[model samples]
Target: MRLTGLPLILLAGALTIATVVATVRWWRRLPIRIAGLLVMEVLLVLEAGLIANRMARFYPSWQALGGTPEVAVVAATTAGRLDASIAAGEAIPWTPPGSGSWGLATTPLVVVPPDYLTCPDRRFPVVIVLTGVTPRPAEGVLSVVLAPTARTNAASLATVPAALSADFRVTDTYAVVAGPGPAQPGLHALRSFDEAVRELPPPLTAPHRLPS
Candidate 1:
């Protein structure tokens, strides 16, 4: 099973429980804390091995981060939004300003405000979508989740559908190596989301860090 985010905390809690059970005597015999730790450590090592083995497989052959391949133009009906007030232009190719970068582009996703044209001044909601470890953005989020919801709801929404580099893939993938500085590639994935939002220009950019 994937051990990420909250699960790690849960593991710590489980280990704590095991530790308590070992320390706190029940009746006569000492709890198996030492033995439990040894077993748990062994299990942890095995788990690490299994995780490492699985994560090694995520280095997909396709380019990540920078460039995207050509795919059939999603029908205006089926594909993501073509042009919205939130978008800088009609789904411009997402190429960062600098040359030195990681990852290749995968899909043609658009990032737009919920109501850019209608509510130019109002700060609406922004959704920075990071498609799971897969190469392309999950169409379901853009098509199934957001589209239907956006049509019905008036909350100005900005979604990053498609257009993310494979570098952003974190789930079931390698760990984020937080280098000394924020410039690290591993950390760039999320910061890049902020950068993308900054590109929105004018009013749409205000909600870069949306409120709680």
Candidate 2:
């Protein structure tokens, strides 16, 4: 689910107001109100600190979050190219140049092709993991992405091998691109990529020609 910046900001504002109201309501009834407020403030501060830490740690990718919108290509590469697809919200197929076969990952993995001008020989499969806007206590969108495919129903772009191995069979080779919205957590996205790679089928033994 893609979440725009406006909704996130609004949600934050609402939460802040709710916290304030709750704090004020209990202030008159108990002496612990002071302690409660102090604790709440401390917790809020800590939460802010943690968010800051994550922002800094994920700066490279996070910076690309709301900036110039471009196609974020994530790809994977094996000795031989295998057919694959991404499932962020929908499945999109990708076939890298120069390979016998290719397969997509289980999650929404993108393919970053080698630049024809510079690194023409570079071909790698990539997975683009998107994060959601909603900041809640429960599991974040990133976490959901990284969660086991067997557990969640979010978008999943995976290779045929990975898909066949999965509880459900994927029917295409493409990247799953999700719109900007509330996501679980980015870590889940990474995890999904890793899982897809790990679960992909081993390379074929003989060369096979594509159907013309």
Candidate 3:
């Protein structure tokens, strides 16, 4: 028979009742058996609690790793409008345009909003393009083949962040542009984003704690 949580709980309760009944009937007899059963019950309860804690933690991590791999594209007619509206804030943006094109000359196009595009006092959302595999160690430089794939994959897997936002503090207003790659380049981007979001330090409340 399949053992389920409810049945196991019932069985454990029954066993506890049986143990109590036996102790009441024979107050000082079979001390070894009674002690052993009590020890077993305590261990069972501890094990169940540990398992429950693990499940609670594991479900979120597993969900972030698993799901549909697709990119989400939010198109803006003009870069200025995108910069003024979406880019307004401390947040950043990243795109993978032309990264999927199959050509040595083809390179991902990156656009940064001009300071004049928006109020100088307002912090615009910075769109960072994570380049594919590249021999160069410089940031944003990706390998020619890998760059396109990554961009494409990013577009395909856009839904992941959308879905994850329901459970976690995912920024719904953010934008991602995925290009193409050998597999899906977006997967790496997603991984990188996940790591970044997870590693972010809690905001410092005291002005003295703020960096100079």
Candidate 4:
């Protein structure tokens, strides 16, 4: 849990008030009152020390909470590049560029058609899918959910399953919420799904292409 100064301050104030009220109520009971007060003091002291240690980093200012243009670009660039409705495999934590994207470990789940490597053009119909927040591979979902239907129609769809914050093994504190609020910097994150229509595989070059 993020220990911020405001919460600490509020907790300290509450504890102080509680201690005072308890002491006043038990003024005649010296031993009990003193012990209660001591316990409160210890809590306050521990809280203060923790806040002091994390003062510089925790409880960021309003300006710091606000999103900057550079951060927005980074998020947009790598938003859904992790895993989507395109491929299959165990996703690895990765970012195309730097750590600016979502400030969290992002992943790139890639899987092409079975014949992609040997196909003439190696240019598969890449479908970037954003599934419900199941925290599973998007490609797997497509294969199970749509494979039967796709086969019936002779359809070939690739999947790239990517999510903003889904590396539970990485960090428990990882989180992302898409909203207009300040906490969710990526307001228009769904645009990544739209933008993926034009996105080719990483190389976008000859190596991934098939031999003529």
Candidate 5:
């Protein structure tokens, strides 16, 4: 079941109600009553926590609560050219030119659009994806994915554009949004660039069409 949704909420409420009724019905039986009461208490607490989680969105899914890593780009360096990578729409590990100055630990992953090679002169807009936790090389493709720390700011991330420009054909315009973090600086960077970002994945908003 989903961690947050009406269905789960209804199920929890039903369980709580069942526990309450059972506890009351077994009141005369000491052991049965005690067991029912204990079960009821636990159910009530779980119901309350589920309700709060729904409201606050602290955990969007059971996997998130269980600390399971989200799908990430699996970086492979077998592709010899940008055309090869773009054609396959593969994710590649990139060290952002001078990422050391930015205080980044893991190398960022880059996924170029499948149509990248089709338009030689056309520069694509960049979408900087920032996750709450660092993603492993397990899944996904396309877009510039950055795993920044709490201390990550626009200044520290300034080299990103330069690095991407050197490695890929990208325009000055870009969009910044929290893929799923304190992405205030990213938004500010968007304004600084004075252009819109497109092709954002699910849970992230975008105005243009997603990459092909």
Candidate 6:
């Protein structure tokens, strides 16, 4: 079964309750009681951990816990296939190579500046736009509209620029803009603004911790 959802939490709770009832019913037998108590404790801990995961979303999926390929590597290898019809300054549907680990249900979108076609040697800075709903790309800048919680995670955010660099001519420097959502957190050294379009080369600051 998939992890980190209401169903999993309910299953864990049910198992814990069953263990507790079994322990009480078998109290007459010393060995059974001891084993039941031990199982109950374990189940209780498991239930709590599951609940916490549901609330905090530490491990969205089994693959995320085991760790997937780095975003840079995946982007370099798999993100090379671009449709012939794709044009500059237009939003392109992107799977975002390493997004499997983030458990994204929808594909992310990327918008490169119109000059990106003519300016072959020029590497443009990137802007990460985080939104809870569908995103509308801005003009002139390389915009990456991320699905909610697609590594808005500061620890994982650093790898994104590197990933984009593999396929697109983008610089290491990037700025983040958080739209309305629960995924709001300090994105590594990158500070998030309500709207930061056309603001080239934002200042880098100390990393901030995200809630676990």
Per-candidate Cα lDDT values, in order, are 0.33, 0.35, 0.37, 0.36, 0.62, 0.64
The ten-residue window of minimal lDDT in model 2 covers 134-143
Over the stretch 1-212, how does candidate 1's per-residue lDDT look in tens digits?
A: 24333455457557756655655553244446566666666666645644454456342222522355555342211212323323322233344333112222343234333343444333322233333221222211111111222122112221221222221211111111111333322222333333333433333222233223
Q: Considering only N, C-alpha and C atoms within 3 Å, which residue pairs clash in candidate 5? A: 72-139
- Local distance difference test, candidate 6: 0.64
Taking the tens digit of each residue's C-alpha lDDT, what string does model 6 give over 94-204?
765685555444677787667666555455667777653434544445777777554447665556776786777666667777654454556522334334554665322
TM-score of every prediction relative to native: 0.21, 0.20, 0.24, 0.24, 0.44, 0.47
lDDT at 57 for candidate 1? 37
lDDT (C-alpha) at residue 84 in model 5: 38
The predicted structure with the larger lDDT, 2 or 5, is 5
Please write out the lDDT profile of model 4 over residues 3-74, one tens digit for every residue.
Answer: 555676667768877887887788789796788778778877876765664676643544544643342221
State the TM-score for model 4.
0.24
**What value of lDDT does candidate 5 attain over all alpha carbons?**
0.62
Best by TM-score: 6
The list of candidate 3 runs beyond 4 A from truth reads 1-4, 30-37, 40-212
Model 3: per-residue Cα lDDT over 1-212, one tens digit each: 11234454466666767666665666666785678567667856845754564456443333443664455543322222233343212222233333233322345332323322333322222222334422221121111122333234455444433332222222223323223434344343333433333333322221222223
Mark the regions of model 5 whose C-alpha exceeds 4 Å error after superposition: 1-86, 132-142, 184-186, 189-212
RMSD of 5: 18.1
Q: Residue 91 CA error for candidate 6 (Å)? A: 0.8
Better of 1 and 3 by lDDT: 3
- For model 5, where is the 10-residue window of minimal lDDT? 132-141
| Per-residue accuracy of model 2 over 17-59 as CA lDDT, tens digit each | 6666777888786765776677667667645644564456433
